[model samples]
Target: MTRQKATLIGFSAILLWALLALMTIGSAPVPPFLLNALCFGIGGVIGLVWIGFGAGFGVLRQISWKVYAFGTIGLFGYHALYFTAFRIAPFAETGLIAYLWPLFIVLFSGLLPGERLRALHVIGALVAFVGAGLIVMGRGDAAGAVPVLGLSLAFLCALSWAGYSVLSRRLGDVPTESVVVYCLLTAALSVPAHLLWEVTVWPQGGWGWLSVVGLGLGPVGLAFFTWDIGMKKGDIQLLGVASYAAPLLSTLALIAAGLAEAKPILLLAALMITGGAALAARASLKP
Candidate 1:
């Protein structure tokens, strides 16, 4: 695909992720690892059906085991760290730290072979981060003693995802189909983790089940596939800057769902994020 088309496709992942908070709330009472297992299991099945219809199972065999390993570590490790961090730390602070991945992606992409680190990219990323920070901090509960370990893990969570995304550019040759193995392996890993750490609890109702399906089908499933395409072939830096929009959009989704109150700060965040993305887009388009 053309770079523009690939970038647009990657941006779709952000759109789907916007629904993550809303869907997760709807799927409530399911513990994190159990929820991880269910969603990734559904995501894996979706990948299986996709491959079965188009590329056939044979395509999977052509992929290297290392690629599968990398994908699994990226998907599973990031979530594992995130869940653990939240378990230990206050949600808002931990989430703010974890959400640093986009900025990290922007910074790390500069290290990739063909990518350049432009001033505007950094500036735009910072601006967008401020917007995302406002949203996260605004939603935060009253402050308490800092949980150092949790904050550290949350930082690692950012690094894990940023590293995964940037490195995907290096493994550009790997087929997106390989994410299926990643999802399945992640699901397998989550099962044992759940068994050890969490009690079993399924979705409580049809709405809950539908929400789980929604997550598997979109945010946790196809988002990865499209993201691979974006990282491999699209404007990675632009996508990095644009990713900050996820928090803003996610908040809007929550408000629309009546889970959160609409706030005046969202307006400023919208402007900052929009301006930041515009700056990044300008930089990307320059000759």
Candidate 2:
């Protein structure tokens, strides 16, 4: 794919993620655990199927099993840690905290040999941090504020996600398609655990099952393929920068859901954060 096409895909991936978050506000009765697993597991399998169809599983033969293994573990950690946060915190708080991965990546991507974050990277990261905090705090919904436990776990989710992204890049010659498919394999582990927890501690209805299936097809399956295709074809930083759009899209979702009133102050904070992120993204054009 061309660079321009990759950029469009990158933006599309973030918007898709935003869409999933939006859907969550209206998501049906599936236990969150069961819902998460079905969605993500189905997503990865579809991606791998697509890969197999295109290359007859021959391309997957090129992937390092070790890398795929680590990716599965990383993905397992990422989603489970993230979903757990929702048990103890509000969506806005958990979502904001989980997105701290960009800063974590900025700090660690240098260790991966081929990727590095320079001074402007540091500045951009710091600015982005402030912006993210502002966006979360701007809501003034103290009830939705991140609690101590939720904050810790949410950042853990962020770290796991960061680790997954950086480590996947370090696979050197592993096909990106294979790595992505493998990450979904992690969800296979997650779903059983989720089902166990649901049967023991929570209950779900048929509507919930339907919602989970919808999520599996739309957000999990389609979204990951879009993201993997984009990442393989362009700069990772560009994709990361584009992800800042999630908060904005999510906030718009909140408004539509009538869960929160839209405020001018919140809108400006969104502007500052996304604007700064865009400016920082521009620095990449130079070299």
RMSD, every candidate, angstroms? 3.3, 3.6
Separate clash counts for every candidate: 0, 2
Judged by whole-model lDDT over C-alpha atoms, candidate 2 comes out at 0.63
Q: Compose the digit string of candidate 1's lDDT tens values, residues 139-168.
A: 547334556787788779878998999999
Candidate 1, residue 247: lDDT: 54
Clashing pairs in 2: 30-208, 43-221
* TM-score, prediction 1: 0.83
Candidate 1 structure lDDT: 0.78
Residue lDDT tens for model 2, 1-287: 68778667756767766656545544543445665666677776777777767766777766667767776777667666766676666665556556666556545555556555567666666676676577556657773654768667876977787777766555535555774565467666767777667653322465445556666676555765566655556567767677767667766776787755566755665555555555555554345
* Over 4 Å off, model 2: 102-116, 135-146, 179-184, 200-210, 263-269
Shift of residue 13 alpha carbon in model 1, Å: 1.4
Residue 256 of model 2, lDDT score: 80
